[model samples]
Target: MHGYAHDKDNYAKRLRRIEGQVRGLARMIEEDKYCIDVLTQVSATTKALQAVALGLLDEHLKHCVSEALAEGGEQAEDKIREASDAIARLVKS
Candidate 1:
């Protein structure tokens, strides 16, 4: 019943790719790669993670928050707050 259930496999694949990127980053460090190259890889990894986060946020809003709003009550308020908090965290990062 999870909001993201439909795209769970896609999410998993994206995460696995991110994991591989992280491993590559570690390997770069171990190999004493150029500082700028390492930094560029770090930026790419960060952007990939942000992309995933944004996708999840969009899904939550389109599905979970929309459903809660339709219900209209304490649950709706909670969902709004939860989504707001998530946005705040993303912004802070």
Candidate 2:
């Protein structure tokens, strides 16, 4: 099973909420809402998405990476490299 399998429902709910927030943003633009207010909402949405990403990464390291390590050999090395790449992408974002 995937590392996030346990919290899959919560993740879907959060993503749905974020989707609503994005749609709200589009509506705000259409309504010509105050610039600062719209920007603030955008920042909030970004942070929410980041929070989800970080949570997934933490779970991955704790579950997936740990399992791979226990198995040993090439699988362990591949998991490490994959996790490293994920972290790099997150940092760059």
Candidate 3:
């Protein structure tokens, strides 16, 4: 398993909630709910996914990046670069 496997349960729970949120959005559309209400839920679900992603990124920095840095070599630089790129993509999204 990857490093984040330890967080599987929590991640799964969050994802399930997001899934439910999406289904709720679909239901709202089917029932002709207010556009604003549906958009509000969409925003909430986006933020929820962002929170989970940030948590995973934090753990990677704390554990994986820290370990790489402690080794004091090229790998450390590479890991830092990789993490930076990943964060940049997340931010852009």
Candidate 4:
């Protein structure tokens, strides 16, 4: 029922990949890999996470927020506020 339900499996797969990347990062540290190499992987992982976040936010705006706005009342306002807060959090991160 959530906005991302349609692509839940895809999201799960992406998260799993990210988890593996994190494990790789720990391994790199354990092995004393070059600092730049580890930092490069860190940047890659961060971008991947950001991509997933953007996808979920797009889905929320298209589905959940759209539906709430169509009803035209307090629910719409609440959803808009919630979405704004989410955007703000994303930006801060």
Provide the TM-score for each candidate, comma-separated.
0.98, 0.96, 0.87, 0.97
lDDT to native, each model? 0.97, 0.97, 0.91, 0.98
lDDT score for residue 14 of model 4: 100
Please list the residue runs of candidate 1 whose C-alpha ends up more than 4 Å from where it truly belongs after superposition.
Answer: none
lDDT tens digits by residue: candidate 1, 1-93: 878889999999999999999999999999999999999999999999999999999999999999999999999999999999999999999
**Model 4 TM-score, all chains together:** 0.97
Q: Which regions of candidate 4 fall more than 4 Å away from where they truly are?
A: none
The runs of at least 3 residues in candidate 2 whose Cα sits more than 4 Å from the true structure, single-residue gaps closed, are: none
Residue 74 displacement in candidate 3 (angstroms)? 2.0
Q: Which structure among the candidates has the greatest TM-score?
A: 1
lDDT of 4 by residue, 1-93 (tens): 999998999999999999999999999999999999999999999999999999999999999999999998999999999999999999999
Clashing pairs in 2: none
Ordered from best to worst TM-score, the candidate numbers read 1, 4, 2, 3
Q: Which ten residues in a row are the worst by lDDT in model 2?
A: 54-63
Estimate, for each residue in 25-50, the C-alpha lDDT of model 3 and write its tens digit: 99999999999998999899899999
Query: If both were scored by TM-score, which would come out higher, candidate 1 or candidate 2?
Result: 1
Clashes of 4: 0
